[model samples]
Target chain A: MKLTIRKDQLNDAIQQVSKASSSRPAIPILGGIKFDVTHQGVTLTASDTDISIQSFIPVENGEFVIAKVERPGSVVLPAKFFVEIVKKLPSDEIEIEVKDHHQTSIRSGSTDIQMVGLDPEEFPVLPTIEESESITVPGDLIKSMIRQTVFAASTSEQTPILTGALWNLSEGQLKFVATDRHRLASRTATVQAENDYKFSNIVISGKTLNELSKLVADDNSEVEIVVTANQVLFKMGNMLFYSRILDGTYPDTSKIIPQNFKTELVLHTKKLMDAIDRAYLMSREEKTNIVRLITQEDGTIEISSSSTELGRVTEQLEVKEFKGESLRIAFNSKYMLDALKVIDSEYLFIGFTGAMSPIIIKPTDHPHSLHLILPYRTTG
Target chain B: MKLTIRKDQLNDAIQQVSKASSSRPAIPILGGIKFDVTHQGVTLTASDTDISIQSFIPVENGEFVIAKVERPGSVVLPAKFFVEIVKKLPSDEIEIEVKDHHQTSIRSGSTDIQMVGLDPEEFPVLPTIEESESITVPGDLIKSMIRQTVFAASTSEQTPILTGALWNLSEGQLKFVATDRHRLASRTATVQAENDYKFSNIVISGKTLNELSKLVADDNSEVEIVVTANQVLFKMGNMLFYSRILDGTYPDTSKIIPQNFKTELVLHTKKLMDAIDRAYLMSREEKTNIVRLITQEDGTIEISSSSTELGRVTEQLEVKEFKGESLRIAFNSKYMLDALKVIDSEYLFIGFTGAMSPIIIKPTDHPHSLHLILPYRTTG
Candidate 1:
């Protein structure tokens, strides 16, 4: 494509699609970013079989002309060099032209880089999303939900299905649930969606959602998510992200969270997080990562962790509120820290179902978010 | 030790000595930080045999009391736990008490940590510097000199002596030279020392100097370096760093640098670095990391690199001053980048004897720093 484009706009477009470009492509063309240039704008796309990202640049953005096209054409350039060189280029505008045999020349300031380009026809075309069933959510909310639930997804490939977060939509409410069997994180949000759209069993890879989170801004600006049988597409202003759904059924984690509580306590989230973090230091060194929480009759809680050879650390905290019977429990400190970190409230509610059952934690004032962790069976 | 000390002061002390504390110490005792507490203040020391660092905190700095001594004692606490827990502790003042059997209790705010302390008698004692000969230099200048030369030291253990930087002190000049055989970096500075004191064969591990670089601030404050037969000590205001000198003969590299130059070119450091950096992108992709620089018959130079399958990048630049004969030279781009990054001058002088000879680069203004790299003999 023969065009001179603003370097900043081109840099942003390159960065947006770079995440989907494979470092070691199974097919050589998969490592290249395909550019389709026209008088309307330039579309840059990259894909690696599982995910594809495309970004668009308009001819003019208000008063500033983003691109001046001499001829409309297509070519695929190596993503690594294209991405890095543009960021380091010295000038405000960069001229890219396709020469004989698809060789591309990028001229900016004093540098002239001639990169061997691939035939655009060799690049895999992104599968079109045909389904009209779509849900809209604020970019900020989706980013937050991904941050809260994605980390709990299993990192191991032993059970490939657990590596994705299950997305469910019904009655204008969108919920995300992720579990690795030991710990689970579930977050619910009221999305802008059709009332009768009841969908379930949609498991999107946590890795894909995490990348999407980085591309989307943390603003209330809207994003439309169109879902098909095996693929999902997210539309953000000038960018489009497409990801393939994992080909398995996500487990029903409905019964994992404890319902009845024997002991319930409320504590300042930051304070509790601080105390547990200190205890986590010892547990991490032990590699067991087990820390104990004990509720006392004196209206307080003690957080402690001990190593056989390294001694113990204990924090006596005067909780904000407490109720129900007293109990002692042990759970993975790292898991607890992760769950607590996502709670955005001043205080958090923690409920224990008699030490053996799963512990449920939630923001004190909200019913939309819940975190559950299985307790360690400690002989106390 | 039984003292209530300011957490910030203690934290700073912990961070300073932490580098000498090995993550996987050879002896169990070496994994602990020895606390020598007296009525005056507290002294923290950590060592992994090869290097030891000791930092002192006094009872008072001017009118502000840093620590209130309740009892005089000594104990060794596990460095891993002690360092992290103190940083996360809730209060400013931490109360430390040594109980029966050397059990240490550290109480701060609502948290209480009891660590198994090793017998202080088992800790290695820092060696006392016996030599009266020493050199003092500004901390900022020494730090700069280390940064400029240390990266050239060999990371491989095959030539153990090349892993250290040779320190040569003659008259009032202190010099550092490091080489991994392929390239060499040398930096020199006049020191604040006795004019007749001359020392040589003091080679400190590059890794040790890198750690020292992190600890010393970028200020023109004075630091005393005391040298003995096999040990070197750096005394900052409140911290003392002791390192063991590597035992081996450094190779004589005096004859390596070319004094008779056929070509001399001076160019803007930043502009040349940028152009070469772009060319490096292609070379890095090819994995050979080789970039070529050719001085043209025209009053300009060209920086370029190419991959057999990926094409080429060329940057033609205007020169401030070029008196070099037309010659083409290739070198490892990464080594050149490393050398250019440490130059504190706006312009740099590059001298070449021939296409096959060593390339010498020095700051255009002064002779405080010099870098030499062997050119790749390209069959062209």
Candidate 2:
């Protein structure tokens, strides 16, 4: 196999695939990235059994040539070392050729690197889903939706299903829900899909989904999502991302969300977040990282935290508006902070169901972003 | 204690002194900074037995003022937590007060914090030194002198003396030397001092010296270095830095530097350094991280590295001039890179003495910075 490609283009493609290449793999061949050269373009594939990433660089469109294939063949080379060499190459274009016994030689400028190559047939082929039930969504929406809910997913693997966000689709709208049992966040968006298509029960590993989310950009590009019984594929631009799905069912979090509240308050989101953050310094040393909130009759809210070893901190937040009777509530400052960061609105509405029940925090403007957090027990 | 200092000024002072405060200290009181409020100003001091830093914020000179001092007293507060709180405080001016029992209250904006403080008597006192044996030098020159030699010090404690830099002064001239026994770096400069006074054979820990160097800037300000039997003090505008001297005799490295060479070459420092850096990508997996240099008759140098398991890389560098016959040599690329980074000259002269002896590198324009690296045995 022989091919000539621009050093810059090859460097970018190599970096993307190297993210999935494991230095130490259960199977020795899994440490390499399979490179295939054809008349159309060059394709690179890398995987670690759990997550697989493949990127393709196509040939010239009109005036500029991206890559030229002298002979169509395939070989697997060491991923990490190959990427490093390509990134540091001193020339504008690089030429790669494969000889007998899978020996590969790369020439760029005055530097020539002769790397040991493995048989491409020995590398595992990542499973691709059949083109039966596929959903196409805007790349920007998926990226934003992932960022909004992925942080709420459980990082623990004891219950693997909870470690992944659940994607449910119905009536041309897609919803993502993530919860670690203490707090839950859900985001919804509309997408064009087949009229008869419906998906609700499939659950992907939250870790794998989170990794996939980072690869997508917030743009107008369209991405196709294809799902099989045990595999999921995301096709974005020139890249293909595949991950294995979790085997168990996700827990039902619908009942945990509160439907009514005794008090509701509307305040500037940024102001409240900063105030809570300052209070957090003192709360970190205390048990439960608890911060108390007291609503006064004059429509003011006071945030306070104390530690026996350190000291105490108190701050009064000026509320823009308030409803219902005056009351006091306590909750984990970190959880509330996380819930507040996802709110896209300038103003947020926080509803309390008493001192011990779960509190609902929703965007005062955008209704799709919902956050529910459990409150910590407080003493006088 | 009372003060109304600007948030930014207080933040900078806290940051500078906190460098001497370690979390895990032998004396618990050493983990806190002592703040003494006098009629003149407020002085902050932090010490960790080996080094001490004191910064003064006068009442009339700085950007902010120590607004009031109802009662003059001193108290020691936790270093890490206090710095964090002050950095994130929401107000321009912070109000601080101390109670009779060492309980301190800090208020800024709507945020109020009351932290537990310790008695100031428990804090360690900084070392006292007179100014009779003092030398004055430009802050920029001292900082540059430290940077050029400190990198060659041994990071390991196998030979404790190798971890300190030898400072020798005589007849208005000062020299700094550091080595790990494998490579050596030396820098020298002229300073203003008494004609009859001379200081020689003083060794200071590389770690402590590096920390003190950071406080000096590349400006025309003068810094006074006071040397005593057991300690060294640096007095700047309003800050005083004290460091304990290393308790060992430094080895004489003057005899190790070669006075004659078989071959020499002059080249642009940056161009040769870039070539050496590219060679590192191929040599990182090898035992010695060795890179071979070949000087040819055509004034071109070849830098290359090869690994038995990986591959090989060869790069060519153009030299301005060459003397003597063609030669081939191999050395550790990391050590060469470290030495090259310290040279301030645009052009550098490299001298080789046989293949097994140490190679010398010096700036073509500046005579202050000099480095010597030992060659590695290469059989390939």
Candidate 3:
């Protein structure tokens, strides 16, 4: 393949796909980024057997020409070397030519780099989705949904299914739920989908979700999600993100979510977070990460943590509205901070269904999202 | 100790001395910061055997009162927990009170932390530096000198002396030199010093130099450096940095610096660095970091590196002046970039004695500093 491409466009395309390139691939060819050249554009593909990413650089973008193809062919260059070379190439215009035996030459400004490439045919092909059941969602909404729920997914490989967040779709409502046994995070939103379309237990790994978030464009752009039996593809502008759904069944979390509350409180999200964040430091020193929250009779919440070796920490925060019984509960402050940081609201509605039951936290403004943390049964 | 101090000032003082506090200490008290409070101010000190740092906050600086001490006493608080707590404290004014048995209470805004502390009496006291001979130099110049020469120091513990850059202060001139056997780097400058007093072979570890660099305020302030037989102290305003000198004789590097050159070239520092930086990426993949430089007859220098697995990279750079014989030499491109990065000049003067001798590099405008790099013996 012989082509001249813009350095910036090539850099962005390489970086987007590089995340999926395997650092330690089972197959040597999997370590490379496959280059598919044609008159229309050049598509760069990389896969690590699980997640595959493909980015395309069209011949023209808007008013400027991004690439000019002299010949159409395919080759797979080392992703590690190619990524770094294009990033530091001293000129705006880069010329690439692949000669016989896959000896590829890249020239920009006064620097010329010659790289030996692998056979592109050896690279694995991405499975094409039927696209019969697909939903379109705003890029920012999808990103926010992933951020709110993905962190609660289990990082351990013991239960491989828990490593992914389940996507539940019914009617026009899209929801995501993730739990690591100790805590659960669920978010719901209305997407631009068919009214009768429904899919459940479509789980994608937390790692893949994070990579997809980066691939999605900014706020105004919309991404189309095409779900298949075992594979899911997110189609954004000029880029496609593909990942395999985690095998096995997702545990039913509906029963664990609390329906009744013994006590409920409304507090400013930032204030409560700031109070719990300070207490987290003391609890972290004890390695238990346990922080206790006690509701006072006069509209205040006292957050405290103590260890024999590290003394004690007490934080007082005033709640906006309190109803029902005054209660005391203890939970992991780290998990609490994580949930609070992503609640895009000024005020939060927190409810407790007794000390042993799960604690529910929901943003008052963005009621579609909710975070749950299991309270620690503390003797104090 | 009982005091109300500005949170920002207290945080700054703690961080400066926290670097000296050992994470794993021979004595447990060394893991804490010793706080001494007086009506005049509050002083914080920490030591890790090899290095000790102390910072003092007076009652007022300019128009702002930093600390108001209610009682005069001393106590030691755990550095790790204490640093994190003060950093996130919610109020500008932090009240610290040391009760009986070193039980310290820290209160800021609505957050209160009681920390289990160690006895201040057990903490190692910093020895008084008998300021017999001292030199005051601009903080930025010393920082720059450390940056220029410290990277060449050996990291391996095999040669303890080589881990430190040798300091030679003679006749109001200060020079720093470091080498790892294969390559050498030297930078020299004129310092404000007594003409009659001279000191040589005072070697300071690269690790300690790096730590000291972070403590130096900025370019405007002057740091008073006190030299002793075993200990060196750098006083920068309210902070005192103490580090022990390495115990060994520094290797003489004067003989390795080639005075007469068989070939000489002057080139733009940034352009040469940019080209070498690109070639370094290719050489790094080969694991040897070998980049060859050949003086072309057309007044251009060709920088290139090649490996069988990663092909080759060639960069052409034009030089302002070329004199004497045309020569070809190879060296580690990583080290070349390091030397060129600190030249502090638009044009760099480089001289080569032969293909196998130490190459001399100096800034055309700044005559005080010099760097010498040993060329690699390559078949090409």
Candidate 4:
């Protein structure tokens, strides 16, 4: 296909779709980005076997005109080389043309690059789902939800379903939950949907979940998520992000979430994060990276950790309010730090069932974000 | 031993010396930094056998007074843990105390760290060099000279001497030369030395060369270079850097640098660099990353390169001056780019002897920096 496009716009489009371009593709044609041009604009598509991305650039916005289109066709040029050449092409406008034998030529300023292209017929076609089963959610909310819960997904390859984040919808609430079986993160938000869908669930691979998050903007823009039997598509702005749904069943995490707790404490989020981070420098050498939390009689939470091979560190923090008796518990500092970072609230309330039980952390101001961590067994 | 110091000062000192400490060491005590406390000040030393760095923080500028030191002594604390703890300490001032059993305690704000330490007697001590063999030069000029020439040194361990930068002196003029036998770089400047001190030579390893460069400031600070038979010491401001000299003869590179050439061209450094960089993106897939240059009779230079597996790129560069007959040559673009970045000049003059001869690049304004690159054989 022949097209001329602005450097910045083309760069953004290329980067967005490049996430799906396979570096080591099982099929040779999957390594390239397919370019399809029509009278309206040019569409760029890239896909691995599991995920696919597509972007479109309109004709008017292009810096230079795609002149003398004797024919309209599609071809696949090397994605990486073409992108790099365009980025460093030294000029504001670029001209691209495809010949009869798929010989692609790109010219910008004083530089000219000619590359052999592959026939577009060999590229795989991405499947598109119907819009009937789709739900609309704010793009910023979707991006925040993914970032808040995706890190908890299991990276271990033993259980494939655990490597995916479970998305569930019921009534008017949408919930995102991910657990590596050690620690679980769940975020719930209200979204717009038609015809009260009943307990529909889709488990998306953690990688695709993260990549789809980047495609969403932090503005008030809305994105439509269309779910089919085995595929899901996220349409945001001018980009389309598609990923294959995980096949296995996800474990039910509802029963493990604590409903009753004897002790609860409220602490400033930044203060707790800073205390844990300071303690982290010392405890990081240990495998568990465990840090002990002690609620004092005077309403102070003391954080302490030690490694026999490295050293010991203790930090004291002030809590806003405390109930029940003084208690001490130990948990992975990294998990606590990660959970604390996504809370988005100034203050957090932590609920403890017992020293040996999982501790639940929730924002005091906003209850939408919830984080749970399993305590580590310590001699103290 | 007991003392208190400012967290920022302690952190800076530790970071400076920590560069000399490696995670793996031949001796156990070598993995730690030796802290010596006295009524005057506190000194910290770290070494990885080959190089050693020391920084002293006097009591006057320190945050806290040297508390009850019933006895003055020294002990070695694990360098990695100590540095991290100091950097993340919560308080403005950190208190450190070492027990007779070699256990050290550090307290800052509400955080306390205790670590196991080693006997300072077991650590290898750096030998003090006599002051008579020292040559003083401006720190900024020395740092620039090192940066300009050190990159040309061979990185391979097979030829140990070639991995070092050669220092030669004649009539109070100091010159640094480095080469991998393919390309050579040399920088010369005047230094303060006795008139009778005609000549001396030393070769410092590239690893140490890089560390020494960091120690020197870019400001007009004075630095002393003290040379011993086995080791060379660089005194910059309050920091002391000592490195073992490479024990071998350096190859002479003066004869290889071309004094006169049949063709000469002067071009803008930035423009030439950008063109070469663009050509690099196309030729990177090739074995040598080779780019060819053809000086046309019409006063423009044609740059081009191609990869059998990738693609081809061609660019034209307008020249300000062309003094000789038209010529064509090919060279590794990366080497030229490196030389271009280090030369502190707006305009660069390139001297070409023939199609397959070594090309010399020098600054039109500054005569101190020189870069020589060997030509690559191009197939017709």
TM-score of chain B of each: 0.97, 0.95, 0.96, 0.95
Model 4 chain A weakest lDDT span, ten residues long: A62-71
The digit string of per-residue lDDT tens for model 3 on B196-307 reads 7789989999999999998998655999899999888999999999999999898888887778999999999999998988889889988989999999989899999988
Candidate with better lDDT, 1 vs 4: 1
* Per-residue C-alpha lDDT of model 4 across residues A87-106, encoded as one tens digit per residue: 77788777778887788888
Model 3 chain B: worst 10 consecutive residues (lDDT sum): B188-197
Candidate 4 lDDT score at position A59: 67
Error of 1 at A71 (Å): 1.4
Q: What fraction of the genuine interface contacts, i.e. the true contacts, does candidate 1 reproduce?
A: 0.95
Candidate 4 all-Cα RMSD: 2.7
CA shift of B242, model 4, Å: 1.4
Itemize residue pairs with steric clashes in candidate 1: none
Better of 1 and 3 by lDDT: 1
TM-score of chain A of each: 0.97, 0.95, 0.97, 0.94
Enumerate residue pairs that collide in model 4.
none
Stretches of candidate 3 exceeding 4 Å from the true structure: A297-299
lDDT of 2 at A256: 82
Ranking by TM-score: 1, 3, 2, 4
| Candidates by DockQ, descending order | 1, 3, 4, 2
Model 1 per-residue lDDT tens digits across residues A5-106: 999999999999989999998878999999999999999999998899999999899998999999999999989778988999989999999999999999
Candidate 1 docking classification: high
CA-only RMSD, every prediction: 1.4, 2.4, 1.7, 2.7
